[model samples]
Target: MIGRYAKLNVYQEIFKSSDFYRVAGGAFLIPVALLIGLMSNTAVIASLSLKELVLIVSVLVNGFPIIMEAVKGVMAKEVNVDELVSIAIIACMLTGNYLEAAVVSAIMVAGALIEEAVSDSARQAIESLVEMTPDTATLLRNGREETVKVETIRKGDMLVVRSGEIIAVDGVIREGATSVDEASITGESIPVNRLEGDDVYAGTTCVDGFIKVEAVRVGEDSTFGKIVQMIQAAEESKTESARIVDEYAKWFTPVILASALLALLFTGDVTRAITVLIVGCPCSFLLAGPVTTVAAISRAATEGVLVKGGGYLENMAKASSLYFDKTGTLTRGEPGVVEILPEGGRSAEDLISMAAAVETGSAHPLATAILRKAGEMSSSIPEAREIVSETGRGVSGMVGEKRVEVVSSDAYGQKGLTTVEVRVDGDVWGCLCMEDEARPMATKAIRDLGAKGINDIRILSGDREPAVKRLADEVGISRWHAGCKPDEKLDLIDTCVGSGLIFVGDGVNDAPALKAADTGIAMGLRGSDVALETADIVLMNDGLEKLPFLVDLSRKMSRTIKINIALSFIINLIAVVLGFAGVLTPILGAITHNIGSILVVALAASLRYSKG
Candidate 1:
């Protein structure tokens, strides 16, 4: 009985506090009362008439809030549209135009409420991302499965994700096969097949088969958590246009107040002055940028592109040059052994077996390709001893009785294919010519970027000059820079900064360059965590096809914002002129002002449906 009473009280409190209920009640009550007043012959209720009762009710419900806010703004010495609207309502009431006062106040409150709803609805995409992560995880502990809060699931803990359940953390599948729906994270509608050793991110659903995932990142360190943080930060960071509007409002509000006073002195009519105040409020001006920005950001999120903020989106629209890291940005980053050349009468099997044995524990992309090739050949790799790796050079270890080393051919200044020279006991045994294949979408992405007016395309790579030149030509990029180290990449980015560069890369070495560029886009699937952290944007599914689409979307959003600003200015100007000329009454001025606000919001919301 106590619990039931408490539940009833909670329900009662929620209903009273809800803005929807308040707005809906006011909206419904006013129209129904107006209709009944029109139908009745006398339209009388108690001592007051129907319209008189409406004027009192509307003033109490809507005008009181506007008046209170206006008073606060004045006390703080900050002038705004609310002050102008409040003054207009007061003036109408003083001039025996109570109906005009009610209408103007109602319009102001209703327009603001509706605009808030639209903005809130547009931001639901980011909110949905926050809700995607489940609260509990099925943890595999000591050969038994137990449920625990996701926060308690630490790294290295094994999580058993059953079919039709959301994966609790970012991890690698240790056993079993499953198809995962990563649409919440990557926005890819088609479920991707995940086998042993394949990565599964947090918030993805296991759709087909059960799998045990060894957690790599748990809690707020997961990719989904980082994405949510990025989005929240993005929403808080304002764009250039928003800053301009804020500055303009400081003067615009006072200017409107001055115009109202001047009209009252010259025309000697309070109604004309009130009309001026009503039409001159900067409703459209305030909303022109943020609405478009929010819609564009939301749309980008739905397509698997996480833009850090509206400022980046604004900069991206004006990007003049595009810089790319050749290996992972343009190419697939997965190099495959195309030719295995044997030297000194050594068989191909002997060279591959020795190389694969030494590279068994390495996480390099080339090592992965070699291991895959060895598996395909049905060769059993013997364990290596005393394995040592040199960054950007090679790996050396003892394969059985022989000392084996796999070093880059670039170390000898020889360039044909990107080869790793296999040495046995300090003698060259053979070289494996590996090729990192260019993505099929690379040419199309470049072509589309050029079509969108981004002409200066360049490749800054650490690879040999011949390979870089070949890739640049193949990808239709005219400018190319080869043999760039990590610092050199940063230097190149510095030179392009003045021209607004959009740098795309996926390696740990690319992290510094990514941070230096005007806009950095990281390939989330295979990119280093440092690169993803420093990048301003992330292509979640690592699809280059979306590059051109992003550019197109940015340009479209820029155009839409400009259109909204211009439309708002023109509408406000026309309304101000009509109001000053006594052609627009107080009620008409309020209606026109509300209409302008609605039109601007509607135009900005249209960006949500725009196609690339």
Candidate 2:
């Protein structure tokens, strides 16, 4: 109940924000006051023109916030459109054109209200992510259920999660088996079966399961918590384009002011100068960068793609060449032994048994693949004793009276498959070739990215040539380099031409390259902490499947920003010319000026629904 209220309260806070309320109230009263003032011009209420009286009141009311914002900008050494909008309103009043002042104030107020509404709605769309996990956990202490605050949950606490309940922690399923929906965690909507020893994450709902989980991570340490933190941090980070727009914005007010003064000197008309200020608010122009960036970031977050900043997101559209790490990026990290070849007159079964026994106590991916293949072959796996593992090498142990060893080998296998050499009693017994499966979306992502203008796709991997070549061909990539170390990848990154270079890899071995590339996208699920930290963008759910979406979003945002700039300049140029010719009144100039701003807001807000 408390959690429900908290989420509701947050929803309400958007409407109740200071900007929304002030602008909303003023937007409503401005029109009403105008109608009243127009009627009272003839009635002459209280021996004064009520139209003029109420129009002044409305102007002051709407103009107060604009003035305050302008003052704040001055104090902060920033000049924004508010400063010009405030000037236009003041100049209208000084010229005794109360109706122009009121109309101008009202138009700017309406624009603010519209912008506020769009921004609030975009924020509301992603804020519900916090509600994915329950605030309370049903603790299974001593086999009795006790509901406790999720924050109070600690590692190793056993919790009971039933069907229709959200799992409150990252844990191992200790008992029972049923289906679980990890869409909230992995972005895959399909519910998967969970058995004893299977892992479940917080925010994932139990579709039809009654299970007890032993918590391994609780509260902010869980994956869901980190995603939320990433979203919040992304909100504050800006793109390089946005920063550039802001830096150039300071010159706008000065240039506009100079233009207005020169207009008055040349035309000998005060109204012309005031009209220049009114039309030159530059509200739409200034909104070009920030509005688009906010909406794009918000849209990406809800789709399970967490972009660190607009700068990185923008880089994706500019990237010409995409370099991918073969393991865990193009291919699923789960390797499987595909073929068992015999040597020294030994049977394939003999080689499989020796390899499986030596790797029994190890947790490496290669070891797991060998064990899995042995099980499928229905071969009797012997228990190995005195096991020892070497990093970057293989494991060795005593399998009964026969000595067994599994070591890395340069031996070649079927094209693009990894090979593991097995030894029996210090003699070569044969090798097992393992293949990392290509992701289902790998080919599609490559093709889609090509259409999006990232045509030069390649693979730079530490795997042997055959493994790299096979994955490259499977994924439709033409260029590939095998056995390239991290430093070698950097050498290739520096050679890319055009807009930029984008590198996609698991964060572990590719951290330096990820940091060096123009844009780095990490496969979040299989990526290490180092990869997650180093990459600019993270594909949280299905790795390769999300790439096209990211590229689409970045390209659209860039195009939208350019379109907004062109539209704003064109509209303002025509309006300013008409104002100089006295063909546009301050009231007409005000409407024309803000039309551009409103259009920019709408274009940016549309990005939220682009995927749909």
Predicted structure with the largest TM-score when compared to the true one: 1
**Any idea how many clashes model 2 has?**
5
Compose the digit string of candidate 1's lDDT tens values, residues 507-560: 456888888998889888775366458888898887788888888778877887
Q: lDDT of model 1 at residue 416?
A: 34
- lDDT of the candidates, in the order given: 0.81, 0.78
- Report the lDDT tens digits of candidate 2 across residue range 204-281: 899995999999988887877777777667766666666776777678788878888888999989888888888877
Name the candidate that leads on lDDT.
1
Q: Give TM-scores for every candidate, taking all chains together and pairing residue i with residue i.
A: 0.83, 0.82
Off by over 4 Å in 1: 1-17, 28-51, 75-77, 141-146, 339-367, 374-416, 420-432
Record all residue pairs in model 2 with backbone atoms less than 3 Å apart, i.e. clashing: 37-51, 239-311, 416-466, 416-467, 507-531
